[model samples]
Target: MIDGVRAILIGDATLTGLVSTKIYPVSAPQKINPPLIVLIRKDADPNKCKTESGGVGRLDEIDFTVLIMSLSYGECETISERIRFLLDGFQGISNSKDLDIEYETEFDSYSEQAKLYVKNATYTAWYKT
Candidate 1:
């Protein structure tokens, strides 16, 4: 599912203008440029599914945490906004599978160690398995 999220974010011109294919899964490389996007898979569980056959279909509910990190707080905010606009309430085909994504929660923090302002956004995505 992280691949799907990366596809959506990187596919957007607005977001690419800001990050320029800097989206990474889990974490970015050391000393890389700032104002990048990182995707983290939090967890996944089976959700009750239904089909016309009156049988339970394979449906999975996954939680993903997206981190917008940048040396400048303003840049972080800009990237965060673009990501939110693209991902919130998004339902479509991604990675050759149908997906339903929704924004769940977010928070702002400063990582003094990395010296980057971070905007953490979490989303719930449901898809057939």
Candidate 2:
């Protein structure tokens, strides 16, 4: 099934240590699959508009989203091996439940992270713990 990872993930602490992600199709068989992690950060302003009729402004969370994709077929045959292979060389993120992330801007916490590794074809979803 196409699993959905819904999280207002703070940019930086994503798919690092104990946190894992997996993505699979709905028609596919069920397995002990991890969730697929995708972090979408909103770099724009929180709100810049005014109310029109209702006067009830549409409030939005001044934060970004953490997307965790699902698993697919064929990969299951070698999921274990694949997971191991991908972990190679990559440093292990701290096992802290808190997002041990640091920002560079005055409000860096609001800025999320999105990194794609072509060599591994796997995406990294970063967020605070």
Candidate 3:
């Protein structure tokens, strides 16, 4: 799921124009520059819905978060918007599976320790196994 989401983000021209290939899973390496994206998978569980035969379905829902970090607030916002446009309400086949991604919520803040602006957004994605 993270791989598919990363592909969508890294494959975008507008997003790459802003941050290049600085998308990382979980955490960025130390000494890395700002204007990067971090992807975190919060949880992934089966939908728990019953099929017509009273069997569990093969659908999974993933809770994911994307964090955009930049040295400037405007840059962070630009990157966040680009990502939002790419992933929000996105439905397509990725990694040989049908996937649907939806934006949930977003929050913005400043990290005084890193002196960077941050925008964090949560998303829900459903896919068939």
Whole-model alpha-carbon lDDT for candidate 1: 0.90
TM-score of each: 0.93, 0.21, 0.90
Worst ten in a row by lDDT for model 3: 46-55
List the lowest-lDDT window of 10 residues for candidate 1: 90-99
lDDT of 1 by residue, 42-76 (tens): 99998787877999887899999999999999999
Instruction: Look at candidate 3 and tell me the lDDT of residue 56.
Output: 81
Query: What's every prediction's RMSD, in angstroms?
Result: 1.3, 16.5, 2.2
Local distance difference test scores for all models = 0.90, 0.29, 0.90
TM-score of 1: 0.93
What is candidate 3's lDDT per residue for 31-125, written digit by digit as tens?
Answer: 99888999999999887667779988778999999999999999988888888899998999876667899999999999999999999999999
Regions of candidate 1 where Cα sits further than 4 Å from its true position: 52-55
Higher-TM-score candidate of 1 and 2: 1
